[model samples]
Target chain A: MPQTADTNRRVVLSERPNGLPDAKTLQLEHSEVPTPGADQVLLRTRYLSLDPYMRGRMNDAKSYAEPVKLGEVMTGQVVAEVMQSNCEGYAPGDHVLAGSGWQDYALSDGTDLRNLGQTPQNPSWYLGILGMPAYTAYAGLLEIGAPQPGETVVVAAASGPVGATVGQIAKIKGCRVVGIAGGPEKCAHVVENLGFDACLDHKSETFAADLKAACPQGVDIYFENVGGKVLYAVLPLLNAFARMPVCGVVSWYNLSGLPDGPDFGPAIMGTILRMKVKVQGFIIYDSFPPSLFKDFIRDMTGWLESGEVTYKEQVIDGLEHAPAALNDLLLGNSFGKMVVKVG
Target chain B: MPQTADTNRRVVLSERPNGLPDAKTLQLEHSEVPTPGADQVLLRTRYLSLDPYMRGRMNDAKSYAEPVKLGEVMTGQVVAEVMQSNCEGYAPGDHVLAGSGWQDYALSDGTDLRNLGQTPQNPSWYLGILGMPAYTAYAGLLEIGAPQPGETVVVAAASGPVGATVGQIAKIKGCRVVGIAGGPEKCAHVVENLGFDACLDHKSETFAADLKAACPQGVDIYFENVGGKVLYAVLPLLNAFARMPVCGVVSWYNLSGLPDGPDFGPAIMGTILRMKVKVQGFIIYDSFPPSLFKDFIRDMTGWLESGEVTYKEQVIDGLEHAPAALNDLLLGNSFGKMVVKVG
Candidate 1:
C-alpha cells in the first residue's frame, strides 16, 4: 500500500519497444481503487513478479501468449491480499496468487486466483519458487530434458529462478550440472549456494572454451534460457542425443533485428542433424498438466525443508522500480529471481 | 558380376571437394578379387544403395558416422550374392545385405551380413524400400513425428525414398499429407503415386505461398529431409506443438561455406521458443531398437502386399555409375530411391 490507500497505482504499457524498453515504455498511473462487484474480490497486491517473459509480452509479435496492448495494464503475476470479497471461496484477508498484472489493487472473480489462506508462510514466495518459474524449471528439466543419472546438464542464466531450479533438480537426479551465468558473483552463487557441479561465467573471454572444459563428456541436457552466445557456446559441446528444453531466450528478447553474419542457421541445422540433438521449445503452462503442479509443490516443499534445494530472490522494495528491474533481468544483471514488493 | 568377372572394381575418395563432389572427387580402380578367409563370405555386389547420408561421410568434419578417408573405398550398403562361404551357415547361392563399399567383390566376416535366402523376390528392393532409407522414414515419422489423425504432415524431398515413405505412412495413419519436391514431375509422382493429399513444387517461384495454400491447417508434423529453402518456408507455417523429425539436410550437404546474411540463427531459435516446436535430429541406425527393424519389415511387407504402400527406384545400371548416382541423389535429381545395379 502506498501513502494514499484510496488510490490504486498501476503500470500500463504506454508504447511498444524496439530494443531495450526506455523509461517511457511503461507509465505509472493512479486511479480510484476498484470496488468488488457480485462474486468478485477486491485484492491489494503485496508482491509483483518481474520476469523475462514479460519482455516478450511487450512485443507485438506472434508468440505463445498475446502481446500486451498499448495503454493496458502490463501483464504479470502478483501475490496479493483480499481487502473485500463477495466471491464464495475467497474471503477478506486471504492471501491469493493472482494474475493481477503490475498494480496495487485488482478485482477478481476467483477463477485465476489460487487461495493461500491468511498469514501464509513466505506469502511472497507464491510469485517465485512455489509458482511459475520454479514449476517451469521442474517440468522442462524432468519432462522434456529428462536428465539421466550420469549425464551432463548445462543450464544458462544459472542463478536465475528457472535455471537455478533446473540445475538443483538435475543435481537431485544425480546429473553433473554445469551452469552458465553472466557474472562471477552469480556463477559463484550457482556453484556454492545452488550446489551445481561447476558454474562458468559467460562474461569470460574464453567462456565457450570454459564450458567445454567444464563438461568434457559433452552436454546431454541443455536447459536453454538465454539463447545468444550461451546457445552458440553450448551447441558444439552437445553430445549425441542431447535434449535442449527451450523455455526462454532472454538474451535475444530485446534484439530488434538480426546481427550481420555468415548466417549460422544452416550450421545450427547441420549440427542438430549430425549430433542427433533433440531441441524442444515449450511454455510450462502449455506443456505440463495442471495436476503436475501439486506434485511439484509437494516435492519442492520437501526439498526446501530438507535443505536439498535452495532459492534466492532479489526483492526490490516499491512497485515503481519494476520497469527498470525488468530491464536488468533481461540484461542478466539480476543475480537470481527478480521480484517486486508492491505493498 | 561385371564384364571382367575376376576384376573387382572399386571407387575411392580421390579427393574431398569443396562444393559438390566432382569427377576428381572419386576415382575408379580395378583390383583382383580377394580370397575369403575362415568364417568370411566372398560377396559379389548386385545392387548398391545410393542415399543422401553418404554426402555427410564425404566431409572431414566430425559427424554421427566417421568420414570416408582420402584413399578408402566409398562407404555404402549393398545387396549382394554370396559367392563363397567358409564357416557355419555355409552357402554359395545366398543373397545378403552387406555393408560392402562401392566394390563388386568384398569379403565380409558374416558379422555385418543379413542373409536373404536364395531366390528372394526383387533382391534389389533390399537395397531400397526394405533397407535403411525406408526404415528411416518409418521410424522417424511414426516415432519422432508421431502424427495424429487429420493433422497436417509436411515432408520435403517428398518423391525421394524417406519422404515418400513418410507421406504414405502419414496417410495410413489418417493425416493430411503435403509433399514438397524439386520439380513438377516429382511433385506429381508424390501426390499421385505416393498417395499424398497435396504436393508442392519447391522449384516454383511462389513455393512458400504454394505451401501455405496446400497446408491450410498449418503443419503439425514436418518430416524434414531437405533443409534449405524448404525449411525456411515451413518454419512460419508450423502450428503450436509442431514436431519436426530432422532426418537429413541434403541441400546443405554440398555447401563449402555458409551463405552471407543478416543471420537468421536467432530468428530460428526464437521461432522454436515462440511456436513451442520440437525439432529432433536422428540417424535411423542410432535411434531405433534393433527389434523395430523386424516389426518395420513385417508391417512394410504387409502394406506392400495389401496394395496400401508402393515403392519406386531409379536403378542406374553399371557399378561405374555409383558415383554419379550418389551425386544425383544428393542433388535431388534421381526420383524416388536411387540405386546402382551392380550385377
Candidate 2:
C-alpha cells in the first residue's frame, strides 16, 4: 500500500543479535505522521538505503559509527520528499537526500537535508552511484590506494557498489583491475560488464592460485571491503609497497565468535612489514569535504552520462523487506547495491 | 691481534636456524688478508653494528632484503679505516662507512662507501645515532606516522636505537610520548634520559592497564618496532586516525612456529577498520633519497650538538662477540643500540 497522509509506518530495532540478525531484530509500528514545527520540514522517505555498515550499527559494540539503540528507528539515509515545509528555501514536493531513516515520515530541521530541487532524474542515484558509496570508492581508490598506470588493483565484492566503482576507477587510471566475488554469475558480470581484467570466484577451490595466475605482476592496490578468507588469499599475493584501502569488513560483521585457525596475526603483520605494505582504513562520512565532494559529483556525473562507468542496484520493494534484504546483503545473496523502495 | 696484516678473521653463516641462532649458526673462519685490486680500497673493520633485522637475514626465507647464504660472510655495516686505496679521491688512513659484514678486513670497489673523512669525531656514532637506525626512525615516524602537536605517540622497544629516536622526535614535534621497554631499568632510562613522557614495562603483569593509564588520550602515532604482545596491547588503545609505522617486528622474528591462540587476524583488521588506522611497513634501504638523507643528517647533528636528543650504545668488545650480541639484542638482554668494537 502507498504511504498515507495521516499515518506513518516505522521499523524500530527490537533486539541486538548474537550473530546474523534474524526475525526478532526489528519490529513494525504505526504512528501519526510527524508535523513540521517552526523552521522545520517534514520528510517522507521515498527510498531507504540498506548497506553493510548498517549491520555494524545493529551491534552494541563501538565502531566508526554509533550503534542503533533498541526501540529506536533504525539508522539509515534516504531519498526523501518534503511533505510539509515551514523552513526557508524548502517547498512541498521537493526531493532531497536526508537521514530520514527506515520510516515513512520524519521531522527535519533542515540541518541534514541536501536539496534535490522540485524534480530529479534518478533521485535514488543520490544514495548509490552519485552518493556515499561512489564517493567512498573514489576517495579511497584515488587518495589512499593511489592507483598507478599499469599497476594491478584487486577489489573484493566485485558486483557491489563500492567494489564495482573502485575496479572501474582503477581501470580508468590505466591499472589492470581484478575483481573477487562469491559466485560465477557475479564474476562473469565483473569481467564482461564492469570491465575488470579478471574476476575470480572467491568460493572456488583454486581461488588463491587463480588470483595469482590472473595477475602476473602482484597486486599493487587492494580495495578491501571483504575480509576473512579473501584477505588471507590476497595477503601473500600483495607486491612490495602495495596499498590496501580498507573500506569495510562485511564478511566478519556477522561473525559472533572467532573462526578456528592458527592465529594468523603474526603472518599478516609480517607480510605487511616484509612487503612494506600500507594498510589504511576509511569511512566516507565527514571524509569528503566540499571541494572533494564537488570533484566526485562532477566526475561521477560525467562518467555516468558518457557511459564510462555503469552502476547496478538491486531494489527491494516495501519497507518490511529491508530487514531480510540486509540479511541477504551480509550473506552475499543479493547482488549490487541493495535499497528499499519504501514509498 | 691489534694489527693483523697477514690474516683476516671472518664470521660466516654456518647454517640457518629453526628458531634462534645458537653457537652452531655462525662459524669463525681465518683467511689471508685480501689485496685491493685497481679502483678498490681495503677496509679494516673498526666497529661492526649488530641489529635485530640481522635475525631475519639469517633465515633462508624471503624478506624485505635477501637472506644471508650458508658459508657466506654475514651481512652488516661497519665503520672502518681505509688501510689501502687504489680508487681515485680515496686514500689510506681515512675512516668510511661500508658494508664490510662480520670481518676484520674487506675489499671494496669504491661502491657502498660513505667517506667519514680523517679525524672525524666519534666515528662510531655514524652506526647508531647518525645512521640507518636513526634514519629509519626519522622517516618512519615523520613521513609515515605524521605526529601532530598535542597527540599521544607510543614507541615499542624504547631503549633500542630506532625506538629511542622515534620517541625523542615525537617529543620534539610536541607530542606526548609513551615508551614501552622490557625492564624497569630501561623504562627509567627512557623517561629520565631519553625524555619520553612515560615509560612502561611490557613484562609487567599489568602492562596493558599501565599503558592505558599512561596515555589518557589514546595513541595517535605508534612506532611499531616490537610486535607480538606489545601490538596486541596497543591495538585497543589506538584512537581514530592513528598511524602505526612498522619499522621492525623484533619480537616475532625468532618464532619458528605459530603461537597457540585463536587467530587474532580478524580482530586486528577489524580494529584497523573501526578506528580508521593507517599501518605502513617500511625498510631503510633505498627509502631515504639524498635530499632526505641530507636533511636527516643536518637535523640529527643539530639535535645531538644541542642536546635535544641523547643516544645510548652498548659496545661489546671483539668481532667474535657479534653473534652472541645479536642473540642478546633479540632477547632484549642488551640495552641501547648494540654494536661490536671490531679491529
Point out where model 1 deviates above 4 Å.
A1-3, B1-3
Candidate 1: give the clashing pairs. A1-A343
Per-model DockQ against the true two-chain complex: 0.80, 0.73
Best by lDDT: 2
| Candidate 1 C-alpha lDDT tens digits along B119-230 | 8899988877888888999999989999999999999988888888998999999999999988989988888888999999888999999999998888999998888889
Candidate 2: what lDDT?
0.90
What value does the lDDT take at residue B81 in candidate 2? 95
Report the C-alpha lDDT of model 2 over A1-343, residue by residue, as the tens digit. Answer: 5677888988899999988998899888899998789999999889999889888899988788889999999999999999899998889999999987899999989988999998999888899999999999999999899888999999999999999999998888999999999999999999999999999998899999999998888889999998988898898888999999998989999888677768788888998999999999988875546688889999999989888899999999999888999999999998998889998
